[model samples]
Target: MDTTQRALAVGVGAALLQALMLIAFAWPAANIAPRDLPIAVTGPQADLVVGQLAERSPGAFDVSRPADEAAARAAIEDRDVYGAIVTGDGPPRVLIASAASPAVAQQLTQIGQQLSGGPAARVDDVVAADSDDPRGTAFGAMVLPLALSGIAAGVLLGLLIPTIGGKALGLATFGVVGGLLSMEVIQGWMSLVPGPYLVLAAVAGLVSFAVSGAVVGLSAAIGRAGIGIAALTMLLVGNPFSAATSAPELLPKPWGAIGQLLPPGAAASLLRSVAFFDGAGASGPLAVLVIWAVAALTLLGVGALRTRPANEPATAAPIPVTTG
Candidate 1:
């Protein structure tokens, strides 16, 4: 096929792949169920509570023991634990980090109410989502748009910068600038996401760098096909599986875990950590971003080496002047 034909084919294939993934993932959003979702437990009956929960719903939760409600609350704030169940007192109280995942908090609250087969359990929200956007939909909003922005940045860099070094520098510059701008828009104007300004900007920059690096590397390595591959993997497969609007546990099976490994998912998680969890749970996803940046940059170097023409000779040295 000619260049145009191949481009059309790629576009169609990418669209089809993304469309199918959208259907597959969106349907499960409403069907979300916790699979080994982590929660903390405190009080003397912690053991009994864990055992009963296991019996009642196998694999629904992964329970841990905290020293007390204070520790449990600390865990929630740090994003180490999503919610907690405090027993031993009259009518067990469920502690939630609604900021981390409202759906998770709600589910735990419902479970607490059902535990005693009595009225609703007392729900405590240790960290709540932004009041303006209580459901924290901004995370979901950011996912696709961020991915697109990454692609646009990559395309512009590739077109404007002819050298690998230039492209890399451009990517970094775009990341930093775009990140700050995003902070102004999301945090300043909307106040939809709340976090330390510098922290949010830094995380956003890193995320943009990761995405742009992947695109640039792919474009260099596989030509146009690489860009398509990167886009499909990042935007299509990564977005919905990210579970930005809900806890990662709510996503189905491996896809949930899989999302956290990708750029879009890692970025969303990192942003969440900065925005609400006091920078908790940031390390793992931050490491993931670093790995992507290193690997993609390396790939870009390799592709550059491979694509250089064999016949292109080294520049001839300048001849020495004979006359003074």
Candidate 2:
């Protein structure tokens, strides 16, 4: 295409990208309602409560009948469910792990109140979030900066560092430092996460390494286009669908689940796990991050192999040609 045509095309592309970004970020938020979110219900009124929930919200909650109130509390703590409804006592009690999801806790609290028919039911927060970030708004907000930072790291390494090995080292260093610095701000300064310092730092570091490594590895394997690919994958799809600001089940069907498979979503879940539930239900997210990191390494290796011959010593020319 001619220059004018190409410029026009670029403009159109930018507009299209803007529309896409809007949809990616807004769609989930607009449609923020629980779908199959797990909640435990127990006691003499368990069946009635479950029926009422199903009637009221219809498929919004995955009601589990834990043995009793204690069992229901255990479920919440184990991260098996976001909250629990305990009946058979005076007023229905709602057990919530606000750290797991403040939004869900609020929903459950409303449900508890509804169940009481008169006075508001007793609501107990089994795992409360940090007072500094009680609603988890600040905690969830951290993912964007981390993601942007990782993207920047990848772009810088790809442009400045010529060798795959050098890029790899840079990714590692960036991951470690980024993790520590971010935790210091979120955990130390803001008091966002309540987990152990070292543990949270390590998880945060891994998250950084995974995202940056993925971007860098993609660029190395596929040239400049790879950066675009990584950005679209991580930013548009992963970040929005991540449900970092809310629970995965709170999002649209399958998308929330899909988000958890990506780096940002996995990182959010893993961070929450370590921060509040003492690493409960952390395996899946941890695995996802590890898989991403491994894939990044593999991509870097492939890129190195592809570029190796360019660095090899040239064959010696015949010296006999100088015998004149």
Highest lDDT: give the candidate number: 2
> Any runs in candidate 2 off by more than 4 Å, and if so which?
321-324
- Flag clash pairs in model 2: none
Counted clashes in each candidate structure? 0, 0
How far does residue 297 in candidate 2 sit from its true spot (Å)? 0.8
> What TM-score goes with each of the models?
0.87, 0.96
Q: Weakest 10 consecutive residues, lDDT, candidate 2?
A: 315-324
Error of 1 at 217 (Å): 0.9
- Over 1-324, each residue of candidate 2 has an lDDT whose tens digit, in order, gives 999999999999999999999999999999999899999999998888889899999989888898988888888889999999888867788899999988898988988999898667798999998888889998889988888888888889888899988999998999889889889998898777887998898888998888888888998898888988997899999999989989999999899999999999999999999998989999999999999999999999988998889999999897765554
lDDT of 1: 0.83
lDDT tens per residue, model 1, 26-45:
76686699998999999988
Give the whole-model CA lDDT for all candidates, comma-separated: 0.83, 0.90
Model 1 RMSD, rounded to 1 decimal: 4.1
- lDDT for model 2, on a 0 to 1 scale? 0.90
